[model samples]
Target chain A: MTLLVTVFAAIICTILWYKRKNDEMRLGTLCFLFWGASLMWLGDAIFEYAELHEEFFTPAPADMLNDLYLGLSVVALAMILWLIILLIKDPKGAVRRALQKK
Target chain B: MACFLVGAAEAIVVTVASKAIKASESKKELAVRSKGGEKAVDALREKQGIPWSRKLMWLAYLLWGGAFLLAYEHVWHGEVVPWFPFLTAMNDPGDTAEMLHEMSTVGVTMAVIVTVVWALLCVAADLILKRRANSPLENA
Candidate 1:
């Protein structure tokens, strides 16, 4: 479930990254984050499949819900970190301009 | 159970290397600044493309982010514990061996994949920067 969510996020970020040629937002970093997480989850999924075999196909509803939450939380956390980086870098200089106005 | 440790370990090493590279780059920048100021620093940057330290730091960030999420997931599954010998698999010899195997296989594979992706990204960025630098409009 977490893997699925991360893969979805990765796909969305990749699309955004490609669409925004100027890349002022630095969406590449977000894409990297999601893709990296997806890769890690893929490893976990492989091991879990090996251990559970056929049982891997089925997951408890509560566990699925928990994983969904975890996945969303991870995405949100990545966005927050990216925002912090953007603010620090201020590639657009929006923050700097706003501050100078005060 | 402890597979994420591999990525975490690599992240730690890469992060240390990145810090060292950053320090060296800063010293070089200082030297350039002393000789010719901000313009010299800008020229050096244009010549260098992207700093190696920044590229390495990006890899470190990716690895650490993956490692943290995996660790959290393992903890959620109760495969990891709060106590000493933190991984639950560490309690038993068979599980320990299996855990080590997983780390060597799945963990290492994931780390390699992430590293490869980062390398490709770095290469692509360098190519784009090079093209832009070579373009006629930029020179004018």
Candidate 2:
């Protein structure tokens, strides 16, 4: 159930991000953070589910997943910071320059 | 927890320092542009005055850093390791060291991928915006 919710949230966030394509950096950073957090939540949910089903001893990959999850969170946070800096330096100007390069 | 807290502190300090440097540069640029009789709007480019949103973003970074460390030391080391009862996992005699190494690798890899993707997206978004701004119809 928790996994379902996480996946659903991820999907909704992704759709919203695409809909706001023009403001991709801002929306993308937000979505990335959501995704990272959801992934971590999913890892925990899986562990709990396994425990409930009496399959708890089944060499869970929780550590690996947690590491990956936290790593992704940090990355997302960094991206958010970068976007903020860009926005502060010159919100419109930065975006304009970036678009010009593309 | 300690490691995570330390990491968070470091991230905050670094972010503030960088912002200060940028602010100084912005001030200099403002002075130069003003001396050249640039438009008043040019003064808005001063980096010294960062928006509240950007400051919040920096805080987010620090929180995330601390969370990563906490997750690594507490959840990863405590819950995850014991759960993964595989011989491969046991290959590392020093459990803490192994976990830390793995976490570091994951962190670095994610950071690199996110950075690259962000750069690409920023470039793409900028191009689209510029085209729209430059259109004759829009100007009219």
lDDT of each: 0.88, 0.49
lDDT of 2 by residue, B1-140 (tens): 12233334544665676577668666766787777656543555433244433544444443453344334445434443435452233556686566456445444333333334434655665576667768999889
Query: How far off is model 2, as Cα RMSD?
Result: 13.1
Clashing pairs in 2: A98-B126, A98-B127, A99-B126, A99-B127, A100-B127
| Local accuracy of candidate 2 as per-residue lDDT tens digits, A1-102 | 323443554577579778874763455454554454444444444545555766543435874465456555444454565467557656458666876894
Clashes of each: 0, 5
- Candidate 1 lDDT, B56-124, residue by residue in tens: 988988898788777877887899999988999989999999999989998898888888888998999
- Clashing residue pairs, backbone N/CA/C < 3 A, model 1: none
List DockQ, one per candidate, in order.
Answer: 0.44, 0.06
Measured by TM-score, the strongest candidate is: 1
Tell me the TM-score of each prediction against the true structure.
Answer: 0.76, 0.43
Please tell me how candidate 1 rates in CAPRI terms.
acceptable
DockQ of 1: 0.44
